[model samples]
Target: MISNLSELLAVAPEEIDVNEPFSRLGLDSAAAVGLIGDLEHLLGRSLSPTLAYDHPTISDLARHLGGEGK
Candidate 1:
């Protein structure tokens, strides 16, 4: 997920703070939607459009997505 966000934001993966909110990471609605799409493709399932808002932070989202969160 960090890799995905880094790719989307065009930044290094190390620059992303898992605990930080997506909004603080400069993720807007369009990016969030794109993120969900990417995740859906990667996970092979559908996801909610408001997932980013619901999870808010990378760690939270990761955990919800079945990853081991930091």
Candidate 2:
């Protein structure tokens, strides 16, 4: 997911702290679309870039993708 973000926004992984807001990671509309496409390709399904709005931190997104815990 970080790779996708890097590819879309042209930002390095080291620059994006998992604790940092993706917006702080320098998000924009066009790059957001690119991110969505890349994520869909990687995840093999569709997801809203709005997910970024709700899950600002990458760790949150990882948990969301992980689904319910045992």
Candidate 3:
């Protein structure tokens, strides 16, 4: 997820703090939708367009998508 987000934002992977909100990382609505599209392609599954808004942070989203305990 960090790698994907970093690539989307054109930032180093390490620069993305998983706990930070996407808005704080400069992800606007369009970019959030784009990220969802990228994730859908990579995961080969459909995802909600509002997923980013629902999760809000990388760690949260990762846990939700990965089925990790949150």
Can you write out model 3's per-residue Cα lDDT over 1-70, one digit (the tens) per residue? 7888898889999999999999999999999999999999999999999999999999899899998864
- In candidate 2, the residue pairs with backbone N, CA or C atoms under 3 Å apart (3 or more residues apart, or in different chains) clash, namely none
- Best candidate according to lDDT: 3
Candidate 1 residue lDDT tens string, 1-70: 8898999999999999999999999999999999999999999999999989989998798788885553
Q: Worst lDDT window (10 residues) for model 3? A: 61-70
Model 1, position 70, has a per-residue lDDT of 34
Query: What's the ranking of the predictions by lDDT, best on top?
Result: 3, 1, 2
lDDT per residue (tens digit) for residues 1-70 in model 2: 8877776677786777887776788887676667667777888998886766777777777777678432
The alpha-carbon deviation from the true structure for residue 5 of candidate 3, after best TM-score superposition, in angstroms, is: 1.3
Give each prediction's root-mean-square deviation over alpha carbons.
Answer: 2.8, 2.4, 1.5
Model 3 / residue 65 / CA error / Å: 0.8
Q: Which ranges in model 3 have alpha carbons more than 4 Å from their true place?
A: 68-70
Global CA lDDT computed for model 3:
0.93
What value of lDDT does candidate 2 attain over all alpha carbons?
A: 0.74
